[model samples]
Target chain A: MSSLVALLHATRIELLRTLRDGSTLLMMGFPVLLYPAMIWGLTQAGLYIDEARDRETLVLGVADGVDTEGLGDDKVQIVPATLETLDAGDVDALLAGAGDGLELHYRAGSPRSRRTRRVVEDRIEARNTERVDAAAVEKGADAALLAPLEVDVDAIDDATPLVQFLIGLFACAFVPMSIIVSTYSPVVELFVAERERGSIETTLCAPIPRSRIVYARVLAAALLGSLAALGNLGALWITVLHGAVLVVEDPVSLPFPGPVVLGTILALVLSAALLVAVLMSVALSAARTHREGQTLANFVLLPLIVPSMAGMLAVISESSRDVLFVPIAHTGTLLYAAIRHELVATDLFVAVGLDLALAALVLGGWMATLGPTSLIEGIQRPAWLARLAGES
Target chain B: MIEVDALVKVYPGHPPVRAVDGVSFEARRGEVFGLLGANGAGKTTTLRMLVTLLSPDGGTARVNGHDVRTAPEAVRGSVGYLSVTTGLYERLTPREMLVSFGRMQQIADPVGRAEQLIARFGIGAFADQRCGRLSTGMKQKVSIARALVHDPPVLILDEPTVGLDVLVAQTFLEFVETAREEGRAVLYSTHIMSEVERLCDRVAIIHEGRIVAATSVAALVAEHGTVEKGFVATVNGA
Candidate 1:
């Protein structure tokens, strides 16, 4: 119970200290507001787009011999194809065909210009198919022979862009971005900066066990990580809801199938915890001073990013159980799968289980090194650290 | 009360160092005992062991009747360790700093106790200001207040006034006297012979981790004519 209180006090003090720092404040608060503000800006841009779409009509110009039989609706008008006619407001758009290709020219204000071109292409395609069928019948052949194998796109998983968070195929960058942005500064500031300023001695002098102090640092870092993930998630949510991500699909339900998104965010939080352990262990082992700790934290970024790239590669192919054992990368695949609503109970368990186990191992290593004299021992550096500092 | 018996500290190195070799001392309630030593004389190491910051290689140290090695948490609760370099958290106000130490020490009504220390130390004028923004004397006062936030019975001070101006150092001397009058066992370590003469009821001059002389200040003055002369004699292996 006393350890718990000490942990709380340590965490509270850490946050307050970091709050007074301008850079830490920017890191903690920036992402949260940045996403929502970006969404708002994008929403405003989208409003202008929607308003333009409502106000303008798609004018399609056709060249000679192209049928006007079944082109499109009242919003779409098929006009004569000519440079003068197109340029003179005789037509707002022009559709022309080469051997097997078609080009459409339209005023930039028309949002449905592509739809208009597709409509005209469909009419021409149907006419061509009828002509081919007629020629096939004359040759005493079946129309099906014209195209024996048909290609079909089956979207088995139809999770919207908002749901996927653009993370499914590209979980590498997103996952690491969330983890690094959240965990790095807090861990370094709490461990390294405090050590440098000599304020950590007061904390060391407290009657609390060394393990409790480490626990407090881990908790503070995890809190920062969680807040950052929430910010990124909020930004993504707003971007998805406004048709900014997938412009065609309307956002009828947000946090769609709430459990999947929640599960994914929870996975990120777990990843943050895992990252805390890794970072703490690395910083403690590699850093003799605060500047060294900061420099060493940069090395952590590569491992986080590299493994995630591998995980996404595996996820792109079929996800394997072997990939589930790779720490940060596995978490990326898990979070990606969760965002897709394709996560099973085993997926969640393996990812979380491996992460928790990894954290326990790293933390155990840290605990073993901890002693009554650990802080002093660390600060009392050898001649090499001085040489290293001087060289740096 | 504080008791250290045959404490041993061997710092393993290229050539192993016996930083504190078989040092022993005791201080009862209402007494100011001074540890006089030159640089690298194990005064800090001995104090660190007594405060449970370092584990003694042999022998035993007890603070307020609790063995330091076996019962370090109780020792930490009963003793407040201070050094000249013991810095305050620049980011925290004095009140915040004191209350945090209070809570960690398991002091009940930590907020109330912190308030009491704030007033007693005359920190009300800048209690809410960051320690980094305060003057050197202000930061030292806050550091002292933090050490006492738990109201420890034993205070181990290692050169607590090394870099202070005359006034701040004099103020610390007065604080040491007050601590002694209040029945606290104050074990102070310093090279200042004047401090030894003015503050210590008894003085133990340490050289190369062993106590060369341990006796009352008056007795030392009788032998060498002055405390400074006696400190010089003890340090020169006389």
Candidate 2:
């Protein structure tokens, strides 16, 4: 009971410290706000370009002998002009006279014009195919035999492109989140700074068990991590909702479904747990200096980020199931898959189980190494050099 | 009371290093025992063993008759330790930290105890201030309050007054004296000769992971002319 109290006290202190640290707050909250804006802005810009390109009018100047009727519709306008009128740049003036906008020039039998003429040529091919089918029908051959096999392409579900995009966006956010966990200074500083300031020694000397001290530290880190995760979730949800409002007219409304919401919350908890375990292990194993410990703790984040990146790219490619099982990859996959309405129960269980297992292994390692002797003596230089050869 | 018998700690390497080489000592109730050594002299290692932070490679250590190796909780429950580096949560106010630590120690009326300690330390002015924003002296007071939160019977302070101003160090020594008067067994470790002379009832001079000499500070000072010279002669084998 006393030990439990000590652990809680220790954890509370740690959490308070992290919350008050301005740099930590900035490091965690900045990216959460910034990343969504960047993603939404870039996506909006891309959509604008696509819209513009869709409305762009292509002007074509046909050779003198080509039929103007084949051009079809107002999608591409065609005008006939004499070589003398075109060569003198008079076609530009002529189009202005006609108020038809810009004019593209073509010469008789020119290969450059021939390549440009391919766009109109596709209609000719369709007409030729119709003629060929007619001829085959007259010969009593099956018209179906003349046609190639048809492929029916269906989307996995009714998930809108916007939902798919959000999934991808969420996956990208995980990279920053993972980086936030690994690089956050307070996590490392909690132990390393205390050791440097001589406070760790004071606590060690106190009538408190080492395990209690460790538990307190871990609990504190976990609490801070959860807070950070919550902040991120709120920022992300708001950004996503705003982006959806802008791009998805009459967006398909789903009350953040219970399972998906539950899964996300669980993922956040497990992520925080894993992060705390890693942070504790690094903090415990590091030397007394805060800088050294910070560097070491930051190193562990590299692997976590790789999985997130791979997951992001894999989502774009709709890659295989193997990608979904890799640490941070699983979080992104589950989140996106849930958004897309394609997540399976078995897959969710697998992802949660894997993350829990990883957290356990890391926490177990930290717990095993929480003895006072290991923590204090583990970082110290050897002692024999202090002795004069014959002094002992 | 604390008893450390043949406590040894070895780190494996190309050639193993013995951090604490068969160190043994005893501190009776209400006594202030000083462990003296230069840098890397095994003073910290020995103190750590007594605190149940490090496991001894050989022999055993007990606090209040509870074995540190087997019954660490009992030892932890009875001992208050302060290392050279003050481990404090810099974000918490001294009062909050003390109260929290008291609660952790399962002390009754922790908040009330925290207020009392704050008033006793004359740190009430800064009681509500974050520890990180406090000066070094204030931080040390917070650490001391945290150590005493549970009001344990044994106090193990490893270079507690290190890096403090003379005035702060003097006040800390007075605090140690008061702890002793309250019947707590205090183990103080340092390389500072004057502190051992002024504060300790008995002194153990350690060298190269072993205690080279052990005696009352007054007797050693009288015999060797000064505590500094006595420490040097004992540690240097002169």
Candidate 3:
């Protein structure tokens, strides 16, 4: 048989074996199911907190003789009290010793707070202006002269909603990162498990080339990683659609254009490729048992997590262009930019192209290291392996 | 049809261990050639080189007129190798594993070939059962079937019955005889003196990564008074 035909046969067998293993099925399914549920719950919590804070009453402590008559009495309730009375916990029994006065805390660094504060200050200034205008009219002066030139700032383009931005960012970043962690077991199993069971020895000794064997294993891992990413993407899509309906009065539209969806898929493929390359390299270099390979592969989780954490921080800042070149970090940035229709063609191409190049380099090194002598003899410790000589 | 001329394998390290050093031997077609050595006697290393799995640091080796380093693909195409550690996929059935390997070898009608091999090896009863659930003997049988699935001209077995029970070992020895009758060049590596005495047409005793002696089993036994004494004297220089 031809070498190519032999490799194909081996690859098919590997794929079948991976599919049959229940552990691999769980590895693929767990991230898909769990991440979506977690994201939905988080979205719900965020929406609830926003709604509650938006409608909740703000208690205002009024200094004596300071009128607050037309400052929207419904939203901000005035509580008449002296500083001493508040400090001494004498305002109300329920509030006794509960700090000096009404806690005027707002959501820190929230856009909502900035807007609300501006409106409140504007209303106070308008009330002062009315008083000034009345006084000016009473003095027989022109009230029109009191009205200074006013400027209006109008938003020309529709702004992407904060919730949609966050959903897209998390879905792109967190889902893939989580999938990487979840699918790690099977990746290790593909090579490490075979080594542990002595099956790798059989494979190495076969009439197939060592390079072909390594290729087959890497291909299987990459395919599995892609499947896992797809499953997670599907779950996130479903959850986002349902959660959007529940939270928004108007149908909350995802800003995901055709480019966004395609970019996300491409980003996922690149990430999966990188992950497979790194994992296969580690697996090939492993000199001990399958358990050792598994232990080493867990280090991959650190790289995956870095992007997710960075994405969470990026959601607050909207966009940080510098992060676009940081491996998986770029994936999150690209997905966010794509969803908002803000991605430049050059940036998108660079991110995808660089990621593919990195994967290729890693895979190249792994292939070079996978000659038959190393793969077969590499697994056994030389001291112990040399003892095989002693036994002979 | 296998030839080895002063092959050497040097591993670079603190001490720079020599795994296979100055190993030389030849095996003719249709012969059950035994390679007897203690553990780590470079038996597996030699076999790996012949199968084109490893590169020899020095000298030359050929299998069926194909140089291991230059024509590895051709060498692989013509050689069947079975190591002591059976590498069968646990999730696959015996039939599935065989067919997969047969296809890998680019055999025509791999499934049909796998079925015939299964029947010949008397493994038809559990052909459909997953290999993970098979007994040691059964797994070994599946492995042997996979090795022969491509029906190559050369066969190399590295301690094929190292861990098998007496009955299973006997069955394996019988299979070796069958392989020889089919006119294939066979190289069987083992440390077990009894297996060598029972199955080998001619034997090369290897020690410290080199072949110390080579002769027919009966001639060595007669010359040394017994096969065990001959092997000890050959290995230890007694």
Candidate 4:
């Protein structure tokens, strides 16, 4: 009971000290503002590019043997010129007859030239459809017979299912990344900063067991990291919803995730936060300063990012049960499955259980190393060096 | 009260180096026992063993009647330790640092104890200011207060006044004097000759991680003309 009290007080103190630093506040609040601003900037840039494409009048030069009777639009102007003139930049693209078929040519390097090629290709396609329909009607046949196959897909509520799936895929990678980033500074403050400022000795001398102190630090870091993750996800969700509305037609709405999917994501993100906190504590155990610890903490990103990136890129099959048992990667795969409405109870149970067990094992191993040699001998050589010297 | 018997610490190297070689001593209540040595004489190592911060490779140490190896938690609970290496949480105010450590030590009324310590240590002027923004003297005062938060019966201070200005150092000496007056066993470690002459009731001259002499300050002065001369003579194997 006394140990529990000590743990609680230590956790509270760790949080109080960490939250008092202005840099902690800045790191926690940065994701909230950054996600929304990034989404807005990207959306604006895309809109500007599309508007510029629509407003430009692209000149298409017609070769001498090409038919130019019916291809012109508000954005494309047809003019008679030789191929040499097109090469000289007098026109954005060229249209010529090649072996009974019409060929279009444009400079690959210029954005305007590429845009003109697309415009002219679309116009030519429309003219071919018109000619085919006219010939069919003249032969007393149905024009619709030219194309017979069709597929009918319904939108989930006001948003298409594909849009919802894409959003889910994006969140699968982003939420875990935010959680890992948020835990970095706090873990450094708790482990490295405490050692740097020399308070760790006082803490080690406290009557509480060493494991209890470590547990408290990890708990505080996990709680703070989870809170930051929530802030980032909320801001990201809002931005994605607004972006979806703008990109889609009128009356379109993003489909809100159901309770099960939301719950799975929350559980996975929280577990990831705890796991990250434990990994960081162990990684920074021998670090003597905050800067050194932060650099070391960056190595934790490898295990987290590699598997998640693999899941995102489909480099690893998410449907494989083996992937569901891998740490960090499992969270991403399960999150993708959950969002796609393919998550199963067995997968979640296995993934979360594996992650929590790994965290517990790592914490226990770290706690075993928290003896006087590591705690009081901070001035002496680090433990690894001591071990290399054949000293314990 | 603190009792140590043949405490040993060996660091492995090309051949083993004995940092503390079978050292023995006893410090009773209402007296300041000084362990005088130059740097690397294992003064800090001996004090750490007494406070249960480091385990002895051989022999035993007991603080407030609790053995360091067997009952380390009880030993830790009974001693208040201060050292040059001990640091305050810079982001925390003095009062918060005190109260937080008190609570971690499982004190029944941490806030009340913190309030009493603040008043007793004259920390009221900047009790709420962060330790990082405070001057060196102010931070030392807060550190002293933090060490005494649990009010243990034994105080183990290892070179606690290494960086203080003269006035602050004087104030710290007075605090140690007060601790002795209050019947606490004070184990003070330093190499400063004046501090040893003024504050120590009995001084131990440790050289090469072994005690060369343990006697009263007055007796040492009676024999060698001055504590500094006595320290040099004892250290030089004369």
lDDT of 3 by residue, A184-242 (tens): 65566666677667786566656566767766765666667667776776677656655
Of candidates 4 and 2, the better by lDDT: 4
Give stretches of model 2 more than 4 Å off.
A2-9, A36-161, A164-169, A172-186, A206-209, A245-260, A263-265, A268-276, A279-284, A365-392, B11-14, B38-40, B221-238
Query: lDDT, candidate 4, residue A324?
Result: 72
In candidate 4, position A94 carries an lDDT of 27
lDDT of 4 at A391: 37
lDDT of 3 at B196: 81
Off by over 4 Å in 1: A1-6, A28-172, A243-246, A249-253, A256-264, A318-322, A369-392
| Per-residue C-alpha lDDT of model 3 across residues B1-238, encoded as one tens digit per residue | 8998999998789898798899888888899999988888889889988887677899899998899889887888888888877568899999888887776667779899999999989999999999999999998888888888988888888888878898988888898888899999999998888888888889998888888898999998889887788899888892
Q: Could you give the candidate ranking by DockQ, starting with the highest? A: 4, 1, 3, 2
Inter-residue clash pairs, candidate 3: A1-B105, A6-B104, A199-B87, A388-B39, A388-B40, A389-B40, A391-B39, A392-B38, A392-B39
Better of 3 and 4 by DockQ: 4
> Chain A structural similarity (TM-score) per candidate?
0.67, 0.61, 0.61, 0.68
Candidate 3 chain B lDDT trough over 10 residues, lowest sum: B99-108
Kindly state the fnat score of candidate 4. 0.81
Per-residue lDDT over B1-238 for candidate 1, one digit per residue giving the tens place of the 0 to 100 score: 9888998999989899999989988998999999999899999999988887778999998899999988887888888888876788788889888888888888888999999999998899999999999998898889889999988899999899988999988888999999999899999999998998999999888889998889999999999999989998878864
Residue-level error in angstroms, candidate 4, position B40: 1.0
Off by over 4 Å in 4: A24-29, A50-54, A57-157, A160-163, A251-263, A314-322, A339-342, A369-392
